[model samples]
Target: MLIAQLSDPHLRPKGVLYHGIVDSNAMFAAAIEHLNGLSPQPDLVLVSGDIVDEGAPAEYEFARELLSAIRQPLLVIPGNHDEREAFRRSFADFDTTSRSGPLHFAAGDFGPVRILGVDVTVPGLHHGDFDDDAAAWLEQQLAAAPGRPTIVMMHQPPFACGIPYVDEYWCRNGERLAALIARFPNVERIACGHVHRFMQLRFGGTLLCTAPSTTTAIALRFQADAEPASYLEPPAFLLHHWKEDAGLVTHLVPIGRFPGPFDFA
Candidate 1:
């Protein structure tokens, strides 16, 4: 099975640029085209979070139109920038899990993989949390399918990625999250967003991967006093290919029309 993960597009109204600089909507379109161009196309696509710049109805409306072009099955969770009710209404057709509550999180089987998306977005705040109720829910889901190769999807990464500014708003009570995931040996990885660049860390007895954005990357800074900023870097996404024998391997795929892929002479 193959899965493509695209994160943090931060879409605005049709003609508006993200943060009045990056053309995130157009880049997201390019990402859709890039996925279509893959040789062996992804069986599923996962949008980790932050579907729009601000939690606006118009943004979600435009987002719906844009996401309509994807060729594969898709699953999504809310990010700090996303509004839960609006997001729910936007994806109402695809997800009929409930009419109320936190972003309709649930587990579903897609061929060889069972994917469970956990919603931990903290309302009116940039940070998130793995509350006791959420932990209980996740534990129940993982326990039900112990042997299946599973992937846990969430917006905020459960571990610090060394970028002090971004780390300030990381998932709170992450230790509890790690402890829960450690008990589930079948978890292939913890797929996350929030951080705009590709970041990976060992956590919860498995690998944790944060997908790069379809727009700008949050500037990388190790200094504690560095101000938070973004860069118009090459937009990218992640591709996870899984096989019965090979386990799960993730590849970083850069978007846009780059230079030629010349063969070695």
Candidate 2:
């Protein structure tokens, strides 16, 4: 199974740039085009979070218009920038249930891999939290599919990424969640977004990778007083391929055209 992960599009109302700098809409469109052109196209596309900038209805409508171009099955979770009501309204079809709550929590099988999409957004807060209910639900899902290769998708990473600015908003009760995950050996990878940069860390004997943003990137800084910053670095996404023998291998696919494939002579 092949899964393509894109994060932090942060789309705004048309004609507006996120932070008055990054042209999020254009970058997202390019990302869609890139995914559409992929050879052996991914079986699924997982959009980690931050689907819009202001979490407005109009913004979601605009995001919907752009995201409709993706040919593969797309799964989305909520980031701090996303409003559950607006996201639920715009992406009604993706929700696992029609009942009112945190948009949805979904789990399913795709070929040989099992996917679990969890919601960790805390309403209006910038930091993430996995509450008792969510943790228990995740534990049940993991227990149900013991020994199956599983991929966990969420918006906020459960570990610090060394950037003090982002680390301040790291998932609350992350250590507790890590303890739960530690019990599940079938959990192969935890895919996350929200940092707006590509980062990988080892946690609970598994890999936790934060995908890059489709709009802009967070400047890499480790100072305790570093202010939040963004740059127009090459927008990128991740591709996770699952093989029967090799488990999961990931590749970073960047946007825009670049020179390649000269004959090796």
TM-score of each: 0.97, 0.96
Residue-level lDDT of model 2, residues 133-178, one tens digit each, is 7888889889988889989998999888889999988888888888
Candidate 1 C-alpha lDDT tens digits along 112-194: 98888988898889898999878988899898889999999999987788899999999998999999999998999899999
lDDT of 1: 0.90
* Candidate 2 residue pairs in backbone clash: none
State which candidate has the highest lDDT: 1
